[model samples]
Target chain A: MREAVAVFRKQILDTRKNRAVLIQFIMFPIMTIVMNSAIKVDDMPEFFYLKLFSIMYMAMAPIVSMSSIISEEKEKGTLRALMMSNVRPASYLAGVGVYDFQCCLIGTMLMSKTCGLDDGPWWRYLCVIMLGLVISIVLGASIGVLAKDQMAATSLAVPVMCLFTFLPMMAQFNDTIAKVAKFFYTQQLYLALEDINNVKIGTEGLIIIAANAIVILAFFVLAFRKEGLTNE
Target chain B: MISVTGISKSFGDKKVLDGVSFSVEDGEIFGLLGPSGAGKTTLIRVLTGQLKFEEGSAMINGKEVRKLTGADKKKFGVMMDDFGLYERLTCYQNLKVFADIYGVGDEEIATVLREVKLEDAVKKEAKKLSKGMKERLRLARALLAKPKVLFLDEPTSGLDPQTSSEIHEIIRKRKDAGTIIFLTTHNMTEAEKLCDHLVLLNEGKIVERGVPKELCLRYDHQKRIELVTTNGETISLQMDRENAKKTSSQIAEFLKEGKLSTIHSKEPNLETVFMELTGRKLEV
Candidate 1:
């Protein structure tokens, strides 16, 4: 447990060192929210664009942060060094995931504020951010394990992030797409947040969030089991 | 003590290590001398429990290295050629992290950094340090845990001569302090200076094993004798044991005639012995 925290602290320090990560953590959310608001469609409600903006920011954060963890460590050979230290695979993953998840959560908070989401019940907003960040972190960690390098990680993550982002956007346009996007993790978070804003704690909304969390948690465990045992 | 018996490793179809066997006694510096791609690094990795061999077993301190648990792993220190340091971390922080991982205290970190002569630069980030400083920092980290066995693979590969000597001095000190060192180096001089015992590895097999002087004598039969004449002309003679009596007679005649000025016998170095054993030069 102490080793995990040391590794986690190291990752946080490394993230702090990277200027681009800082910008992605801080500026991107602010920029996304401003852009979404500036181009609000005439037929669309104000809250609709804000909700979409929050979901996009939440989804992007995990992919970028998680991919960077593996690629940067692999590049520096830090992962190899850590492996040499005899750190357990589970602890290493937890350390890296926690750091990335923290980044995602921070980004989610900034995006929520920029979208003027303060009027909603605070606990629901917190739950939505937490759920979205966890799912994105799992997906990001899976990508980190699979990608070979920084370029490879980005190349793979861009399409996945785009797909997730586009799924919700597609749901906004077509009822058929909405039905399909309901199966996506971020879509579940989006619906849950929308329901919370309407003060309607629908049983389906609760189930969707709980089910997405369980599935992602299971995938995380499975992914760690598969790729975490071997040191690259 | 570390004992490796008939260990072999292959990546895909290419065999990297082939039935290599050796043992390292406690409190002795054991050198693995070989050319590049001779499986020196792979062999070191296996002994240090960082890699698993396809065949054979390595017993480190009476326990199979491959089967070492987390507690057992903390007893060994390793420094490969690639000293994967965190660039953003200060020298102190880097050492601190490893010390923490090993559950050692801050005093050990200070002691190690001081031993490696990095005390002054402990506060400086790794990326800002020079190459020699980086190597020292790596050495410091490796020694921080007070490991029972130390594995060093080309530990001084890229340093300047002065810095290399400094690093070697620290290694010698460690060996003197009763740490069993498993060292792999292509530098024959390093092997000659530090190794109490050595194994010459060629293509993953032990080609030669013994004390440096003994191996030199066993493989290189012809001795190079250089004599300077009174007229300042130098005469060289290669003498085998069978021809030594005859050569001594000739040298005695030269001395009697007041023609001999200086005399010295030249035995083969580790490099020559290595070439004689492996049929190749140590390339880097």
Candidate 2:
């Protein structure tokens, strides 16, 4: 537990010191909030802009933040220091994961309020948001593990940002793309946000959630194995 | 405190370390001296359990390296090829992070900083530090855990002579404190000055091993007497150890004729020994 805390404290220190990453952390969520407010138009479905912003926030923020964080560590060789130390893989990952989740949750709430989405029971609303954000965080961490540096991570994140955010937004217009997008976790998250109270969040939502969890875990193992994490 | 037997490691089909073995007793400084690509880094990685070895075992503190657990990691500190500093953080923050890992407190952190001469720069961001200061901070971080065994890879590789000398002094102080050290360097002078035992690694093999002076003597070439005459002429004459008596009579005749100004025997050094054994210069 102390190891995990240490990792957490170091992550905070590093992230705070990194202005590029800190700017992204602040800018993306505000972009979501501002974009939602700018597109506010009469006759629009209630909370329509909110849902779009939430999807964007859920998908892009964690990927950009987490990937940049881990890849920068690798590039700087700080990850090698952690690997050589007594800190276990799980402890380090969990520490970073918790931080990613907290940031995404804050973004979710900010977007929700800025778009004037009506609140249901707070716990149910939060649980749905938290679950969706975890998937994004895990997927982002995988990108981080694969990236060689911050620049590489940014290049890779561009296409991923488009795939997760653009695809779901595109699904609203194209029928065929909607059919394909339905299988993506980001798409399922948009659907869950659309019906926060009425949707079961059990059928397709559960399936995509379960599948992403497995895929993300596998991605971590494969990427970190390439990093020579197996010996430790 | 550190032992290895028949340790060999390969990357894909290329054998990087083949049948290399050595042990470092407690409180002794052992140097793994070699040129670039001589598998010095590879051997340290294998012993530290960062890389897996295919065909041998490394033990530290009576426990196999591969089998070492969390608490076991506390027994040693490693300053790997890359000194592994968080350049964005202040030096104190860098040391604090590692201090947290080793379960140490503020007092120990201050002591380590003092030991490496980094106390005044504690608040300085690591990237802002000069090269020598950065190396000193790296040493400070490595010593945070008060490790029984320390592994240093090219700690003074790129530093100037004065800085390198200072780093060497810190290493010697650690040795006096009874910490077993495994140092890897391409610097012959450093090896001669700091190492009590050393192995000459050449292309993934142990080409030679022993004390610096002993190895030099073991590979000693024929002794030569160099003379600087009063007429500003320099001359060298080989004197076989077995023919000392005959050479002594010849030297007396030269002295009687006032032909010799000064004469001294040219004994070999670690660099000469490395060149003779590897057929290559230590740095090149």
Candidate 3:
């Protein structure tokens, strides 16, 4: 546990030291919130823009942070050194994942406030954010782990974020597409943010989130094991 | 104490380690001497528990290194050829993190930093430091654990002579403190000076094993005698001791007759011994 904390603390310290990362952590959410609110929608339903902003923030946060963790470490070869240490692979990933999740949650809260959302039942939103953050972080980390370098990480992450973020945007054209979108984990958080009346979260959403979490955790374990076995 | 017996590793069909076997006694400085592509690094990795061998077992302190848990791994310190460093971290932070991982106190961090002569640049981020400083910092982290066994792969590969000597000094001190050290290097001089016992590896096999002096004596049986004549002509002779003794008398007579100049005997060094064993040079 102490070793995990040390790894966490080191990652946090490293994150804090990077100026661009700091700006991305703070400024990007604020910009997204402000830019979404500035555009006037004609006869749009209530909470539509709020839901859109929340989805964008959710997708962006994990994509940026998780990919950065993997690609940057690979680029710098810090992962190799960390693997050589006494810390277990699981503990190291947990520490790094926890920090990534926390940053995303904080960024979500800041985005919520900046967009002038009603902030009704903030606790429920926080709960959803926590759960959704886990799913997104794991998925993003999987992508990061599989990517060879930063360029590959970014190129891969952008499309994934877009696929999840724009899922709801496709709902207007077809009801079936909206139903498919609801099966996406990010869509569940979007539903919570939209807070549409009589809308229920089906088993598919929960199963998708849980299944993805398990698979991603498995990937992380596999990646770490391979690294431990092969790396000098 | 570390023991590796009949260890073999292959990446697909290309065998990297072909049944290599060696042992390092407790508190002894054991050198793995080989040229590049001789499986030196692969053997080091296996001994350090970073790589697995298909055919043999490595026991460190009576426990199989391949089966070491997290706590057991803490008792080892390894420095690979890659010199992995957290580029964004300061020299101090890098050492501190490893110290913390190994459960060493903060005071030990400072002690190790000082030991590696990295005290002055402790605050500098690793990426900003020079290559020599980075290498030193890597060494410092390896030492911070106060490990029972230290594994160093090409530790002084890229350093200048002075920096290399400084690093060697620390290794000597650690060895003196009763730490079992497994050092792999192409520097024959370093192997000669630092190792109490050594194995010269070729294609993942132990081609030779002994102390430096022992191997030199074994391979270089006939010593050469160089004689310079009074007329400015140099003569070289190689023979057994009895023949050398007779040659020495003749050379003395030649000197008395004003026909001989400088004379010296040639004993084999580590480099000559290596060439005799593998028919190749330690090119690095």
Candidate 4:
């Protein structure tokens, strides 16, 4: 636990020193709120703000910030330094997870409050948003492990951001896209957000969230193992 | 303080280390001298518990490497070929993270920073540090825990000669203070100057192992002598045990005739010895 906190503290210090991560963490949600306010649509859908907050910006921000964190460390050999220390894989992952989740949650809250998109009481909405954001953070971590460097991570991240952002944002308009989006965690999150008045999770919602979390988290474990997190 | 027995490692069908074994005494600097493909880094990795070997055992302070727990791990430190610094953190911050892990205090951090001559640059971000400074910071990190055993892989590989000498001085000081050092380098001069005992590795096998000067002398059979005459003429002679008497007679005759100005004997150095054994020049 002490080692995990050290890794977490070091990761936080590193993230602060990184300009690209700073830009992504601070700008993604702010851009969402600013755009929402600037482009005043006459007949905006009630769930439009939800999609912007959860799908377009909140989801994309953590992926950009967290994925680059891992890839940058790999490229710069900082991760190798951490591995050489007494830091275990669980501790390292937990540290990174804590930082990424906290940062993403803060961004989500800011977007929700700034856009006045608070559906129910803050706590209930926060719980649901956090579940989806966990998926986003896991996806980011998996990208960090798989990519050889920041450039490769950015390449992997674009498609991921697109799938999570556009697939759900545009699903309301297109039939085929909506059908495909149904299987995505972001789509389930979008559906959950659309009905903020009654935010009880159902069987399908539970399955989708669980599946996304499991598959991505499993991929993270496999990628880290292949990268020799335990062996060498 | 460290021992390895019959250690072997293979990457698929290509064997990188084969039946290699050596031990390092406490307070001694042992060098693993080899060319690029000689598996020097691999041997260091195995000893440092970073890479697992397929056969045999590596033990540090009488504790087997494979079974090392957190407490056991704290006994040693390693600086890999990559140096592995957090480039985004400041020099002090970088050391602080490791200090926190090792349960060390600010006084130790300051001492190590001063030891590596990095106290002035403590607040500088690592990415902005010069290559030489970066290497010093790495060495400083390795010394942070006051480790019982230190594994250094090509620690001065790319530095200027002066900086390399500075690093060697710091390492010598550590040895004086009773830290066992396991160093790997392709630099024969570094090995000759720093290592008390060294093993010459060729393609993952121990080709030669001994004190550097002793090994050089053992292979000094092809001794050559050069003589300059008073008339500015030079004579070269190869001396052997069988012809020693005749060579001395010839030299005496030359001196009596006042034809000899000066004479010198050339002994084989570590570089020549390495080439004679491996058929490859040590990379500069």
lDDT of residue B3 for candidate 2 = 85
Tens digits of lDDT, candidate 2, A1-232: 8888888898888888778767756775687677676766779776676667767777877888888888777787787788778778788788888987876787677766665555663456667768777887877788888888778888988798789888889999999999999888888877876765453576767888789778877987788778542222
Between candidates 1 and 3, the one scoring higher on lDDT is 1
Per model, the share of native interface contacts recovered reads: 0.52, 0.72, 0.56, 0.60
Flag clash pairs in model 2.
none
Highest-scoring model, DockQ:
2
lDDT tens digits, residue span A66-147, model 4: 7888787778776777767777767877888788788778887887777675556456667888888788888888888888
Encode model 3's per-residue lDDT on B1-284: one tens digit a residue. 78888889998898988887777898899999988998998887777666778898789999997888767777778887564687788988887777777778879999999999988997999889988888898898888888898989889997898999999999999999999989999889889988999988877788889998788878767777778787878787876766867886787689678876677766687778778877888764
Best by lDDT: 4
Residue pairs with colliding backbones in model 3 are B228-B261, B230-B259, B230-B260
TM-score of predicted structure 3: 0.89
Give candidate 3's error at residue A77 in angstroms.
3.8
Residue B130 Cα positional deviation in candidate 1, in Å, after optimal superposition: 2.1
Candidate 4 stretches with Cα past 4 Å from truth are A117-120, A230-232, B225-265
lDDT of each residue in B1-284, candidate 2, tens digit only: 88889988889899999998888899999999999999999898888777788998888989999998878777778887564689889999998998898889999999988888888998999999998898888888888888888999999988999989888998999999999999999999999999999999999999999999888777767778777777878877778878778778877877998988889876788889888877888986
In model 2 chain B, the worst 10-residue window by lDDT is B75-84
How does each model score on lDDT?
0.80, 0.82, 0.77, 0.83
Please give the lDDT score at residue B105 for candidate 4: 91
Judged by DockQ cut-offs, is candidate 4 incorrect, acceptable, medium or high? Answer: medium
For candidate 2, the docking band is: medium
For candidate 1, write residues B1-284 as lDDT tens digits.
98888999998898989988888899999999999989999887777676777899889899987788888777778887654898888998888777777888989998998899998998899999999999888888888878888989998887899999999999989988889999999999889888999999888888989999888888767677888898999887868878788888989999899888899877888898878877898765
